[model samples]
Target: MVNEISNPAAVVDEETFSVRRTIRIAASVDKVWRAVAEPEHVSRWFGLVALDGAGVGATGTMTFPDYGVIPLRVEAFDEPNLISYRWGNDDAADARPDVLDPEKSTVFTFTLEPVDGGTQLTVVESGFERTSAPLENLESHRTGWNEELDKLVALVEGEA
Candidate 1:
């Protein structure tokens, strides 16, 4: 039987200019890591992810059906434990270039931990203060994480 973990929605902190969410999934750390770090599995739960390669500094694009493609780069990674991505969040940049704006991009880090029943995943997206619209973007991303992570939990757990 699968463990019923209560995953909460993402939270937006205006003072820190970030959004955070924690979820417990009934799956192994390796499995959960792939779901979040691998391009193929990431696309299944998040947006359509297309990455140049693995490891830090690898560039990529996540395309949402209505939102267009957002340029992203793997900022950091540590095996099946943690990974972070820096992505463009500038709404004014309608062109959606292939490069990330150092001034307008946000960094989102995913931390995974092994738990009693499965794995605990925490995602913190920061640097919203640098975005064109901090409040607007923060709220939007807060909602986005909640929706996205829920799908991630479902996908990983279902595969177990």
Candidate 2:
């Protein structure tokens, strides 16, 4: 098994305090999209994901081993291209998918584009300034994306 780590270019926008990373995956857009958009595939690489629906307005919970369960709601969904979700801003123990509070949430978007022999996946996690610990959250997620995306690439490419 190849343990390739994806060095995502994480940038913290000074104006908005958002974190963004762009990575290239050695997989088709459809395959990458499935790994990102579908709850079943997501759980394999990202975390334990459970979604209520497939399109926008869908709700779900993603429980990370260290971060616990975070409330999430789908904000945008474009098949094989884009999928965005708003998750709880703070690491509160009582976070629940049914209790959505915009004041306590940040939005993360995944955009995929077909490239030569693979897909270009860009992730932008915005609204960090709205969270309780802006800088900490930004740094943590920056590192988290790098590790998780690396796992994603390994999983997808290994299957191919």
Candidate 3:
């Protein structure tokens, strides 16, 4: 059976260790899922590409031409709701402080919740044991997720 745990309310922000990052997006769950889950759609907004992962139990890859390609394995895929993945590649770029550990995969999750105006999308990335990889990765992703989230909002709102 899959083990699911509720995300903590507070994030860790220490010096030596801690792995937690959360960002919110403005869009419906369905819209966000479309913008993020599908390979074609994801390439248009989020990452460079979406490999095998499309539906539940899908495994593939995501890449950034400037950086490199990383293997992506989907774990939790609940349509129009949640999508989780393990990302990392063997390329040298994956060794950077900002990049995730290729040996130790990290968990990338998207949680959608309904709100007054539209859906609220929360992205939480954890499982960063390697300090160097998470360093630059965490900061870079901070901006990346925000931009991608906004793009998803635009795509969904425009369709509506």
lDDT of 3 at 120: 61
lDDT of 3 by residue, 1-160 (tens): 1112222232433353233444334445666677767788788766676554366567666777776666677778887878887776322433542344546666778777776555666677665555346656555555555555566556666665
Q: By descending lDDT, how would the candidates be arranged?
A: 1, 2, 3
Q: Supply the TM-score for candidate 1.
A: 0.95
Residue range 37-141, candidate 1, lDDT tens digits: 999999998999999999999998989898888899999999999999998857874536676887889999999999988999999999988887889999999
Residue 19 alpha-carbon offset, candidate 1, angstroms: 0.5
Which digits, one per residue and each the tens of the lDDT, describe model 2 over residues 55-74? 99998788888767777889
- Quantify all predictions' global Cα lDDT against the true fold: 0.89, 0.83, 0.60
Candidate 1 local accuracy as lDDT? 0.89
Model 1 residue 81 CA deviation in Å: 0.7
Which predicted model would earn the best TM-score? Answer: 1
Model 1 root-mean-square deviation: 1.3
**Candidate 1 ranges with C-alpha deviation above 4 Å:** 1-3, 93-95
- To one decimal, what is the Cα RMSD in angstroms of model 3 from the true structure? 7.9
